[model samples]
Target: MKRQIIDTIEQYETIIIHRHVRPDPDAYGSQMGLKALLEKNYPKKRIMAAGTHDVLLSYLAEPDCVAEEDYNGALVIVTDTANTDRIDGPYFDRGAFLLKIDHHPNEDPYGDERWVNTDASSCSEMIYTLFEEGQASSGWEMSAEAARFLFAGIVGDTGRFMFQSATEKTFEVASSLIKQNFDRTQLFADMYEVDRKILHLQGYIYQNFTIDENGAAYIKLTQEILKQFNVTVAETSDLVGSLGNVKGICAWIIFVEEDDQIRVRLRSKGPVINTLAMQYKGGGHPLASGASVYSWKEADEVIGKLQELCRNY
Candidate 1:
């Protein structure tokens, strides 16, 4: 699969890159990293990064992201997208060919040339492998920009190498990127820095943590609380992942109230929370999953199922 894409890259004159929406560090990292690499090696090719510039503001300043109109007869590289529906940017359809580089567990082919290695820790790692060992002719050297972006993606997806997915290979990639003189300390500080207000909200959320008999922690954020904090569902979705690390906690769930539904974030250590989430019609990786329930009462029902699963696990 990688060789096929490398062949396409060699043949294509124009290359455009994209990723999932909302621009997490991993998505942005893979998008920016690949863009810089392609442009460095194939300088003659026209390459553009596509998607939300506002969301990419933290990682990128003056953006090369372009619109669909700018992308006729170009090769589109979609990275870090788990599913086809989540791939944003209209330029994808405008491309002459589609290529995908993703590391998510589920691989649905979105492009003519798809390189989906669920075994890889991050999409950045896949790109790193390509440049190092794949059949890409030039094996483009990583620029400072490329190194930083790729490092960010690896750090983001692996939770700064804290998640189970982080492995020896992950660190090897990080080490290689660091050799390009990336500011490791500054990047780490920037990546982990949360707003004081969000920190306070997290404190408040933690103060209200509810633990069941089986040591599963849970927190529910009401609409009024969310409004008071000026936080959206996006801000709170990843919060549960932090709670799963508590010493006494075997699993955790955060339920945030939105308009008419409750968004549930589920996480576990020894148990497979994805199955638990699936019981409520939600799905994700084994350690993490999410779902939405209609009402608070429904949320209680979902919690009951989770508790049962916890007891059994």
Candidate 2:
């Protein structure tokens, strides 16, 4: 679609930026990068970047939720969000216009003007393309900050160039960002620098893992376990993928204990995990999928479904 994003930009005196909730590095990167792009190119406009914060490297560009009054005569741009329900902030309805930019396996277009590309590795890559096509000049002369945000989103979505979605274009975007001359060493260090306590907690979680009949390994973080460790809720969920890295496992699952449900994250090397997740009213990419369960019984039932799905892998 040759949708003129700049046309939408030009219509607004102010712009508010948003991303998906439970923000990841890619979501944060694309949101921050687009915010910088707007601020640099359209100096006369007001732009606010806002989102939920609970994960890595997102702190680099903290979100500032704009007041509803700021939405007047403004265009709201949501990045890296596939669904409107997941978009951060409550002021989407307050905007004069809405636009979406995302790279997800599924596209649920949320705005008046939408650009959704599943083939692209990251939304940041799509943002780079938009800037190139729109000829919107960067404020910092292709600033280091913009490059860092874009690169962070790229690396997060590509899993540091390890995911199946990584492509030649992904590298091309990376090359372009590198040309902006940001501090590469510090970027890598900042992005991957895991806290030692997190590692220790990971080790403990790994100790309680179990593999099912079809090589679908899963770990459950019980409330008691969380109490014993004195750690945060997400700390355990973040470590689930490492368990599947065990020599022979094909699929891995993590069931984290939350207030009223168990949050389930599933990953596989050879199967479309989305097939399994969709069965539970959840969905994502083929390789990585997630769903939630109301009780331990439902969790076991989901595990049974995952076992059936794992057979194809």
- Per-residue lDDT of model 1, residues 251-287, tens digit only: 8888999887788888887688887777677899998
Cα displacement (angstroms), candidate 2, residue 231, comes to: 6.1
Residue-by-residue lDDT tens digits, candidate 2, 1-313: 4337776786787889999887877888888898887788778988889766664443467888588798887888988988988998988768888888888855576678788888999999888887776564322245678888998889888889999888998998899899986888888877666445567778875677788667878778777777777656666556756776676677888887888778888898887788778877789989888888888889988877777777765
Residue 75 of model 1, lDDT score: 84
Query: Residue 39 deviation, candidate 2, in Å?
Result: 0.9
Best by TM-score: 2
